[model samples]
Target: MSTAAVPDLAVVASPWTLGPLTLPNRVVMGSMHTGLEVHDDGGAGLAAFYRERAAGGAACIITGGIAVSDEARGGPDFAVFGVDGADERFRVAVQAVHDEGGTILAQLFHAGRYALVGGMVDRHGDPQRAVAPSALPWAAARGVVPEELTASEVERTIEDFAAAARSARDIGFDGVEIMASEGYLVNQFCSPLTNLREDAWGGTPEKRRRFAVSVVRAVRAAVPDLAVTIRLSGADLMPGSTTDDEVDALVHDLLPLGLDGISVGIGWHESRTPTVQAAVPHGAWLAYASRIARVVRGSDHPGVRVIASNRMTDLRDGEAVLADGLLDAVALARPFLADPAIVSRSVDGRFDLVNTCIGCNQACLDRSIIGAPVSCLVNPRAGREVAFPVRPTTQPRRVDVVGGGPAGLAAAVDAARRGHRVTLWEAADELGGQFGLAALVPGKEDYAATVRAARAELDQRGATVHLGRPATAADLVGSDAVVLAPGVVPRSVDIPGVELPHVQTYEQALRDGVPAGTVAVIGGGGIGVDTAAFLTESPDESLRARAFAERWDVTVADDVLGPLPQRQPVAQRTTRPGEQVTVLRRSGKFGQGVGLTSRWVALGRLRDAGVRMVGGVQEYLRIEPGALWIRDEDGVERAVPADHVVVCAGQERLEHSLESALASAGVPFALVGGARDARSVDAVRATSEALEAVRSLAP
Candidate 1:
């Protein structure tokens, strides 16, 4: 092992040999469903999608697992490999990637019990029925019980795996990968909870290993010249499922079966584990990949590469993981979805220009999980890259933006990049509007990075920025076009005693400090839950210091105090464990509007804080000096004692005085972001509006 002071990160950008082929770089695009298939053209849209990522500098692209058989298939959105004319379209995709100096691999998979029952047609064009080793329902997809695969059926399934690999190699794929992770078919057979079969495929660890090993052996025999890889879950993160030690043994057993590489995965969709969400700390699962790598390195064919994945958002961290000597390469799914040029930007030392993935799985995974076309919230051109290529405007105009928030910043940067004269104004002294406040919430600091990237782009494009000045009609006199993106204003509930001085809005509470003592947060939306998290945060600086120390293996004193002892009492004092906070909402569910994946982690944090939660508020009677009166869900009235009351019900659009003024002057104005729609204020809506407004203004 090289113990050099600084491990060369250029190695990540260097060529590496995998079996008979040498890849251009160490970076591999992780396989994921893009929902960009063309039913009429046999997945031509999907071809263009992978073409964009390959052009952006991915060394190799692994297509989303292509269904081997009709019975073990993903939904209609997933690309089918062996269907009529589908192989021809896949050949086009493979040529597209190869033309761009990249290799494309086909991930052949069988969904097994996890297959969407009745949602897809079989390989022979019949209604698809899911089959598994045992007749059990997949926990992730409720109400879908799979039929048990008969002994003869299991033999055919193994043959199907070999046929898929042969089909991939014949269609000009650079390699093949078996999907054995994420609670899919291979994973189901490996887990005792899902596979209760008393046959040869189950009842023991070695027997369970038989199915996966047999598939690999069959694929290798079918395609002797092409490379073969397997993606395996290092830990299922669920009860009665495979653990790290078991995965270690399993990989060691399969290495001698002509496998070229292994990628370690963490968690399953049905498992009650937080894996890839933004709330999961960055590089949290690298340790799992290290464990698997150790087992493979000790084996006979130790040269086989190991890839690490889950929540690796940037190249610097990827470089660090590679430097640790645990894994050979790091794979990114959402980061590439967020910015396909992540590798090229990093290679050019343009880290500031790279648009980082914030891991807000809103558009990418969450939308795809519900059958929507996959996209990026920040980039806005993910799946539609072929449709919306960024080009220089034919005719540009002088544009003035009225806010320095996400919408205004995005518009200014994009318009300026298109050779337009753009200027952005902010009433506040800073750039990020609500995004800055969002960063203050625990476990959400990554949002601020997006703001920073926007700022960098604005600087690079030379867009004029005016801070501490609100754009008005006078300032827009000479502008050919004006954009109204003043964002939104907090709305307080209408009730008696609502105007009390103690009643604070969510924004005010975050900008200012939470009042000392008990606090009651009203509303259970994303804003409310986050505010509750902020209020209930540990007050001990030492505790936070200790946490950081333990996580990074640094040393911290237990009672360490900072300079200015009197002013920073909390820095030296112990935690205030008795400090209480209550969250109330009119709706039954909490954390609405929070991204589906991150909501789990957010709620878990609030639970750990011991926050008192009450929903279905019958009424907000009034507010007094020491308490607020409200009715509970059971039709009972009560006085909730609190030193401070926070209202996070929602926000109202700011008054449109600027719009009316621009209209009177005929300034050819537009409204973007919360100024136009305050229903769901998120990066997706804000960035989408900005991209559309900028593109439409072009002649």
Candidate 2:
């Protein structure tokens, strides 16, 4: 295969000036809530996390939001400023990054009404209440209303921002980025929906934006040498919020405040528009950044660059976006988590070897939302660099990786990289097993890229791959150890009419498209929902993009984004024209196994496509040539019009009978992925276990 990059990525590799700072490239490792902010190891683990990405060639890395006050925390684990023992933590991380010739920034943040974690503890170990512009109760906060910030409190908050910036500079941070976007405290103060005050900080749009301007003015005065930037919302994506002109006007308000850059963010936490989910097309939000850049360039402060973030993960897409000459830089968060060396690989023109973020959010966003430590599904060693170093093993051994699915692929690559001689055996002709099928689904093309990356890595590490070869006891005779991961098969349900010609397994439906007619899918797990999404998606790329826009109401235009961008109401989107798909589950939500952050997006996609989701299906009455009958929750029998019934009730382990046979042959082996457990198809767990299995085999 050719190693040459198709697109000329010279533009992404080029440098651009942001005020006083000259970045090495246009790729910025955007800030993410790592949940390591509250790690038990003080700052050692957090230092490792940022230093690894810095070592991987990130021109500049922005740390996750650091709360200026306890009342401003987005969650409990959020990093809080002015707290005890914070300076040492900041110094440790700063030293680690500086040692690698990298610049790190502290992101000053406040949550306002969005602080739902019962508020972070104060510097004196006393609890504080969530504070906001108004005494509004957030829906997720369960009736806990934020205490309306008094005028005095608001003034103190601004001072806190300045103090935090000064403290960050004192701790050796290169700069500080204000977290004023994505419906955070500053953004909430700028929106009418959240800010219901009439004091100097409220009243009109100007007053609503005064809070942000004041923050910038104070921070600039406190630390004039700090490379200061702000993350402002190009579009809040919230209904009845800041207008497009208001957002544009606010950009002009901050241009003269000694700002260096503006990183454009989109969508609020409660917004209906899905911004960063996999369902969203790559670079869907770039136009918003371009809009902001136009405002900056048209003004006197054109030197202050604009950054495009959210869904702009791929380096190729980043190159294209930058080549079009709209924005100055592309900020990627999860992509860095997936592959820390993403920028380096692109710089070396080794794009094929980069581990692509599939945008599943299984580990990163999902865990962050629930206040759990964040990691990557594709790369399990993301934040655990200190625990799982990539140093070559002193003793090399012959390792046979049985099964070339995701688990086998990850294990083979890791083992080979650790100085083990590996041979991969697959029952199928191709490598990816379940993941390849998942890639067929709409908006999931990146899933296949993961398999491709692993394959290339295995080859680069000198691992032998045997396609269309199934391992047996004889094949494992000379192997010092084995990593068994034969993967799974479609689970069989003994329901009536399964033997009919109309019935097919998920594997069959994914490989061969179903006949044109209403389709009925059994089960409502992640795989089931994926199968349903695949059946209903348009085959043409243009048509698919169009449908996605219609369903989510994406604005790819250069016009300023405002409130209520969704063309169709939530209720009306359910009635949109599409192929009829019925997803039946015995109980629970439609996307049961999916992560909380993405589960709603997947279900919403199905709902928008006119998919009939029938939960609490008491009984599967029967199936005929053209339809299926089922007992509803109310014990009412109904006929679902369907030409074909696809079974996606999950999977059972494929019994290759190799595990026992290999053990009897006196071969030491470890079971991973489906070979070890078949309760459900969890790619996150499977991949992590595979990496751990390799570590266990090390001498």
Q: lDDT (0-100) at residue 21 of candidate 2?
A: 73
TM-scores for all candidates: the values are: 0.91, 0.95
Worst 10 residues of 2 by lDDT: 567-576
Compared with the true structure, what per-residue lDDT tens digits does model 2 show for residues 240-297?
A: 8998899999999999999988999997888978888888766777778888999998
- Model 2 clash pairs are none
Q: How many residue pairs clash in each candidate?
A: 0, 0
Q: Evaluate all candidate structures by whole-model CA lDDT and list the values in order.
A: 0.77, 0.83
Model 2 alpha-carbon miss at residue 474, Å? 1.7
lDDT tens digits by residue: candidate 1, 1-699: 111112335667766777777876677899988766534565566777787788877877888878887776667666566676778888888988888878888998888887776556666667778899899886565687888999899889989989999899989998898999988888888888787888899998889888999999999999999988899997887876776677887898899998888987777887666777755556666667887888888889899889988876777767667755657887888888877777876777666777778778998888877768888887787787656666687777888888877777778777887788888999899988887787776546666677787787778888889999988788997888787888888886886776888889998887776667777888888899888877765444334444434543323222222221111123221222323788888875799888877787677767766787888889888888778789888888899877778899888787757887878888877898988989777768887887788666643
CA shift of 535, model 1, Å? 2.5
